[model samples]
Target: MPTLLDIEAEARGCVRCPLSEGRTQVVFGVGNPNADLMFVGEAPGQQEDLKGEPFVGRAGKLLDQLVMEEMGLTRDSFYVGNVLKCRPPGNRDPKPEEIESCRPYLEKQIELIDPNVIVTLGNFATKLLLNTTQGITKVRGQTYPYGKATLVPTFHPSAALQGGGGDVISKMRADLVRAKKVLATC
Candidate 1:
């Protein structure tokens, strides 16, 4: 199997979609390759595009706090990445063609990491992984079997930034608690 580093290098040179032409860099996953948990987000935001790292922007900060402070996890203890390696223009939702082109890469990453639990942050990641059109609100905090992995769908940290309000935060915290418990049981 190819190492994450090897995959990262290949992604950097990928032109599988038009996203490659606009991206500053391919933001692959960051964190422990051997982690039991993997967090998958939608796509790279501006900060991530600039830094060539996933989940390093405002949303990332919120996620760091949730995983580290709230859930008692660390950046080095879990793998975090996105469905798309490249940023969609103007931080727009990834086009269907773009997702189709890049999905194999994400699937390969999952195969390599083989985490005990996989967390899908927001709709795009959840929809892509689950192969469904169900919104995050309907599926967040639920667990489902995906091949050998236990998948948890949750709101993206960006939702907090989007003024989803205190209710959303409370629900998010509860979801994290559930996720932690699931990890323990697994």
Candidate 2:
């Protein structure tokens, strides 16, 4: 089997989608390769694109804070990735064609990491992974079985930053706890 490094190396050079044309580099993923938890976000924003790292801006700081406080796991404890490795120009929602082109890489990452739980941080990741048309509001705080791991749907940290306020934060915390419980049980 190919290692995570091999997958990332190949993803870095991907031009399968138009996104690759605008990105500074592929934000493949980052964290402990053998972690029991994984986080899947929607796509890279401007800061993530510039830094070549996912969740490195204000939203990232909030995520770091929540995971550390609620789940007691730092960013290094779980792998963080997006549905698309490259940032969508202007940070718009990723187009369907873009998702289709980039999905294999995300799937490969999940295969290699093999985490006990996957916490989807927004509508895009949640819908895609769950293979559903539902929105995050309907599915947030729920857990489902996916392959060998449990899937936990939750609000993206950016939502909290964008006036989702304490309610969103509280719910996100609960969702993180839900994922942690699943990890502990497994």
The model with the greatest TM-score is 2
lDDT of 2 by residue, 18-114 (tens): 8888889999899999989999999998999889889999999999999999889998789999999998888899999999988999999999999
TM-score of each: 0.97, 0.98
Q: Please list the C-alpha lDDT of all candidates, in the order they appear.
A: 0.89, 0.92
Q: Residue by residue across 1-186, what tens digits does model 1's lDDT show? A: 688788888988999889999999899898888888999999999999999899999999988887776689989999999999999989999999999988988998998899989989999999999999999999986799977889988899999889996777777788788778889998
Residue pair clashes in candidate 2: none
**Highest lDDT: which candidate?**
2
Candidate 2 lDDT:
0.92
In candidate 1, position 22 carries an lDDT of 94
